[model samples]
Target: MKQFLILAIIVLSIAQIVARPVEYSDGNDDVLAPEPEPTEIPIGKYLLFTTKANWIEATKQCRSKNMKLISILSEEDNDNVVKVIKAAGEGRIGFWTSGNRRKTNGVYFWGNEKKITYTNWEAGKPDNVRSNNGEEEQCIEIMGLNILKWNYRFCSNELYFICEEPHESIDETQPISLLFAQQILTVQMFGYYENNENEEVLTPEPEPEPLYDLVKKYHIFTTRVSWADAMRHCQSEGLQLVNILSKEDNDNVIQAIKDANQGEIGFWTSGSRTNNNGTYVWGNGQPLTFTDWENGVPDNLHAHTGYGQEECIELKGYHILKWNDHLCSYRLYYICEENTKQNLFSK
Candidate 1:
């Protein structure tokens, strides 16, 4: 009877083990999965202030931070700024840059006294439109409208601003651990993912080529002619009047002229404000993205009697290839750019 009781007890224990529900978890219940790291704006090398302040106050704030107002000297710098602004989720807001023309109207320069070589101006911007109280729109801001473009606003207007660390303070020989931290932050902010330890990592896609090459060949015409005549001649030769769009293009044109043994002589470019509402544009109707104007130029001065408005652009060798506004009827040598592959193939 005792043996039978022992067998029944064993059977009961077996039945309990089989019938009871077994809870299985990958430590999700007892051990909380580490709270995810909160998303933050990747500042990189910039300091973004969400609070609004006037241009003067913004400059003071940046100075207090031991930094300076942001100066975007290249397209990459501008893109990084846009990314930070977008991350902040501010729509239709403008941010103050270091650009200001308060010292000399219509001549924008950064805090470092460097002329703004790269520009992304909005249509009809930097108009220098005066306010009702006669306040000039001399301060530049990056507008977050349809696209990230620049617009000059009243210096007293309150707006968000960006500040940049001085290049001298940046140490390229940072510790490896700091670099790893930066990489992790980048992965988190940019949505980069990693494979599991056992899984094979996929290769990244190659970056796309730039839309246009910065370098271009040019054809210099030594014959002096009016801007209108130069345009006609270039069109007849299956080329377009050279449109200097960037510093690289300007340097290339200067070198090309030197290669032709041309001395320090002025050359007419495709830029002109003739009948364009006081704005300059290339013969192809494209707006100017870059400019190298000399000090106190484009003054629209009627230097010569009986000459029309100073509506044409000339690369004056006297100014070391700086641009100057001259009368359209003034005869000068010109440059013509080769037809692009797309243009040639299309023709």
Candidate 2:
């Protein structure tokens, strides 16, 4: 019996070895597609606010911001983008890159071009899920920089978002608080004769206020108003504070109110962090997205692993003064801003 078993084991091993095929060429090791040649993008005048938006939403959001989706050029460009995202300094993290694979199968293609070359996917990513009926997945997402991983999710998941604009576009008439330039209020150089032997240098028009600051500019904050009360005040005047997005967004709010109020006290913002799952959803009912959390904060009780659990909140007065978690009924002096988009930046 022992001899027979040994002979059988050897036969099985030989059969297994014979069944496997070895490729003649080592070329299989050279799998990744070459990175593509990048376009000569203008000095980026605009730094897009990243969003977790799927393809459709991303496109729409970027357009609303008077911009478009980012287009990746080379691998080095990807690396630089990662650097800018990290340097943003908001505890809240992640930024949309110019890469997405929602169109071609398992291919990371640029939104604005063709000729895909470079690839920066995490290990075993772009699995490209297939259904029993033979449906193919076309959407992909990248998260975390240290080891950026791409995953296939529904096209409508409303993840983060990315915006793109020519560097020259930023110098256009945007608001100051939105983009910080010491000379934000200074005169424009374009078409202006500084040292020209012509007309005197006209006071450069101030860049338009950032969307958030502009919104707040048209708003008025009252003291110790309940959430409902605040909402009512805004509604009465055809205003609503339901669209805050980034930390810069929240900060913009505080800054507007503070500057407008002068010695006024702290008020409640329409933004909020969740006490459940630590998923920060803003007043728009969209997730309170963005990597803008100040460190050691938004603790969300630290119960949901590292992510916290506070949602539906208001920013503190003095412009994004660290946020707080309070019952909405606590009757805090709250803020109410008007949205002119649904109305022209009106009160």
Candidate 3:
């Protein structure tokens, strides 16, 4: 009887072993790995700007430094400016602002038509006292007080100012293209409330510091690739083709693309030969010197010729099909190159 009980116990043990799935472990390795380095924003620096520049020189100063002149669009920003100034010393006071009345003396204007209607002006000031400083003191400036009220100064006077640093904010939540780094959505909600929907961007503004650590060089496509494929190739190299802005802007970009493509490639462009009204013009604001379109290319099937979508422009030659789309995505091998020109800030 005891032997039978022992046999029964052995049978139950075997059943349990068969029922439970085994989880083997070497006792050292972890299942999950750490995130990639680029995914980590190192504790390097915060993107912010604070200036103590006096009025006149500040404009050129920000420009030289590749920054927009400081814009005090909110109380928080105002406080930040004040803190920077106070941290410096008692002597440091006013800095250049986006305001100007030089063009129309006595009339006020913010650098981008930002309404100063909700501004914090000192009592009984902007009185147009007509100071004997010289010409009509057209530019605007900001000077501060120990209290909330700050004084407005002339723009021509020299002062130091602050520039905000750029921050990389990737919305991992969004479906937007992940091709490029995402900048913060700098919605000027408060600035808009004060009728300041725009910054002084129409006028040429200063550029920001280099985003990448160094001027990463890339090869222009020696063989033409479609725009989609070109984008993928650039992604592999960590760069993109030169997006030309004007006729002169094409010079350096084209030179770089040519060097990379080895005279056998083309590029896609952001423009078409035909405009909305059907005028065929170079995206770089110049008339074409040559044409090479498979002989009968530009079929213009849609017939929306003037600035039409089908009317695309490509760099003809060397088998490289660098092309741009009427829809910003028509595939082609147009231009391929990379550059890092400093002092060229984005507006």
Candidate 4:
């Protein structure tokens, strides 16, 4: 009976060995395998996407994950997001945020139309720098050596992004022994599991969105054309030449011009004089009560010679956005106003 018991014990031991879990190791033969690192570290209510993309592209990509691009609403939220980016070994690359301009010279509103009560612009940022032919920096991006500073850039520029969704319930029954292994596996499945230094992202970023909704519904025609042709172009598109009726209106228009970063070139408005000595009238005939002519401008001088025939008004963006008089036949960039009546804040 003792010999029989010994034989049974040996059989059981052999079976246990066959059914045991395989030992995990780094394959160094000397060191045991370390616990797997988590694929995602909970930071605030977001998951920082390590993949890079433009602002518009990032927005759609995040939405596909049932999340939205990270909108830094407060200092606390900003710090939390920065932490997550760092943990992902992506602090060096900046992430796209949800802030964008609603109107030219207008305050930036978040994607959900949240007021920008909090901002962390890098010193002298949101500069809206648009070179002579460069595009406007309308989209906000969080990029710096430290990963918290921010600056505005053209929405088409590509960069890493963060996506935030409501946190789901955590499973309390999960064993601690399996947590690390699951994390590593989950990250690997994301196709972005980079061992940090060797991280290789395999998943492609979300697709791009059209550039229409990223800015105000206004259009700036960089093509120089005679005032008559400019008016015709606007009419063709159901638009009209811009009419600056008030200081606020002028501010908005000038902001658009600056945002275009088309340099200090001239843009024709709807104001023009019937004759050199007659009053200037808006294209819409609203009234000639408002004017933004530069000091000593509308001199109505025809090229500094001959009769005073500078009949049309052009806003020179480079000259402190001041207005000047030019021949109606002179070619220049123009602003077109659409007839859409939607509320600006509806988005």
Candidate 5:
């Protein structure tokens, strides 16, 4: 009877083990499972304190919730926070950011003492005490009037503020089940398993090819024409006279000309003198912050015998792509700017 009881006990233990769920670890290389969806944060990830408070009080408010006032570290992050603020429906209202100054004429620092590497200050902003405004304008605020631009404000000034908190991210490098691994492999071999009900079918737009299959964002017009005539032609062609915004833009323009199999020929750019006589501005009404003026250029001398003021600039392509003042009516090769985002081939 005792022997029979022992056998029955062993059988009961085995049944219990069979009924329980089975767990396994292959001890293989640490492979990552698919990441779970991110958890949503309250106040839509970034919270805004609409209540008015001094900078010190604002810091406290954020610290109370284990968060810091928003630290914009990247352009993408800045844009995303701006979107969140817009969604908050605050119509053209300014709010405090985390950038602050501790000493006069000192660099601003983040609230959490993180290094400040990125800034999107408005034009002529952070001009502390420029108009004898108190030197105490050490705190930074996002001026809604300028749209995602920062400005210096007095720390004592009561204003709304933004805050951010850390979120827990799960480690995706955890092992997945053999069945899931097999399914993933199958999907990789084939295409993704699609459900027609969930997948929206739509025709994709055709990509626009570069001009002459050579340069992107620009078309070189080898046809000689005066600056005014070139501008008119570009307008008629839904283009604009080239505006060299940076060194990269300058290089690309030169490359486009070369790609067109054109030799070094001075091309008329949109750069022209303003009524101020001295101040030059781009055709797009942008400031002349960048320039590639040739040596002793804009001497404003007229062609042959210095008859009239040279009010226009031309890309002296043969002379190292340097710019020289030229008569607007002088005939020369020119380049036209293309809007790359548009499909030029679209019907």
Candidate 6:
């Protein structure tokens, strides 16, 4: 009977041991369990999504949610995005941003088509490394393990992503009274008057007469055309090739180009050496008073080499927006300028 009881006890002990749950460990002191996938982790005005997807699918998902992939426009934006990812416990997983150079390699822009002015790329990054299949790394991802710096990556790589609510949507959520007060404040700031009925009335500001009694309007044509063809097209439109005679004029022309959002490589300006004197003048016979030339530009290399005269000037070099001389036959986008007479009868 003593041997039987001892054997039964041993059997019970073995059964209990076998039934006990097995703890999992991967050579670590602390045991870890599979974590649930995170979804819609919100931080500040952005949302972090942990579900993995390729760049194209990620963009589609964000759009389906009525949001856009986040655009890190500044250092603060970068920091906030990193914080959101870290807080979600996915700091080791890269997240896709809205920046990509798919349209024009080496020229990154946000989904909204605005040029990315600020960047925090890792060393030797954005090298545009090609895959074995010859696919280029055109999309940007915030490296989760590398101090949250940006790196160009293959667009088809599955990864987590972040999204940002548009400012217009936020504004729509504001209380009506608050929006009304903001409108009143804007009216007051713009020099409005309160009538006897206590209603605000916006008083029109006196319009200052434009210089030379004419208002200059700038236009950008995205169609690639030769310098002479561009000049002829502008003339056909009752305008002239642009004459950027002042810094203000140059700035205005740049703004116009940006507004067009046509992603042009360069624009033909009305600058060329009409006479053998070697001085550049506008097609409209205006002397070149202000010049924003890129360093070592207007070199006229082709002309000197007897290929063709590089007399026609263009606003080339993306973001540099500087002037360079190219052969007249080379096709490029162009800008046109129109002058309108000021309305003398208008109050």
Q: Highest TM-score among the candidates is held by which one?
A: 5
Q: On residues 155-268, what C-alpha lDDT tens digit does candidate 3 reach at each position?
A: 434454444432233221211110011111111112111227654322312331221211324355545555456556765776654344434345555566655544454456
Identify the candidate with maximal lDDT: 6
lDDT measured at residue 197 in model 3 versus the true structure, 0 to 100: 65
Instruction: Please provide, for model 2 over 183-291, each residue's C-alpha lDDT reduced to its tens digit, 9 standing for 90 to 100.
Output: 1121212123456567544343444233221223446555677765776777787767545555556667656666775323445556554333545555555554453
> For model 5, where is the 10-residue window of minimal lDDT?
177-186
Model 6, clash count? 0
RMSD of 2: 19.3
Candidate 5 local accuracy as lDDT? 0.66
How high is each candidate's TM-score?
0.38, 0.35, 0.30, 0.39, 0.40, 0.39
Residue-pair clash count for candidate 5:
0
lDDT of 4 at 284: 73
Q: How does each model score on lDDT?
A: 0.70, 0.49, 0.44, 0.67, 0.66, 0.73
lDDT tens digits by residue: candidate 6, 1-347? 99999999999999999987665567785876554445778877888888898776676687677788887888988888887787777778889997876332244667554558899999888897765434567788998674688998887678889988864423322111000100111111123578999985545354323212245798888889999999999999999999887677888888888788744488999888846488788786667767788899879889778897788898884756788999889989999999775432121
**Model 4 — which ten-residue stretch has the worst lDDT?**
175-184
Clash totals, every prediction = 0, 41, 52, 2, 0, 0
Give the per-residue lDDT digits (tens) of candidate 5, residues 1-347: 99999999999999998986544445654654444432223466688877777665666576677666777777987898888877777637677887775442264566544446788888998786522212246778888653768888776567778878743331222111101100111110111233677762222133312211112388788889988899899999998998876676788887877777765778889888835467787787665656778888878777456676677778886746788898887889988897543221121
In candidate 2, where is summed lDDT lowest over 10 consecutive residues? Answer: 175-184
RMSD of 5: 23.1
Of candidates 4 and 3, the better by TM-score: 4
lDDT of 4 by residue, 1-347 (tens): 99999999999999999987566678788876646555434466787766667776677676666677777788987788777777666667678887776432255756654547788888888787763223466778888566478788776667878778733432222111100100111111111346678954334234322222313256899999988888889989888898876675788888888788864679988888754357777787555555777899878778579654788888875746788888889889999986443211123
Off by over 4 Å in 4: 1-44, 131-134, 166-347
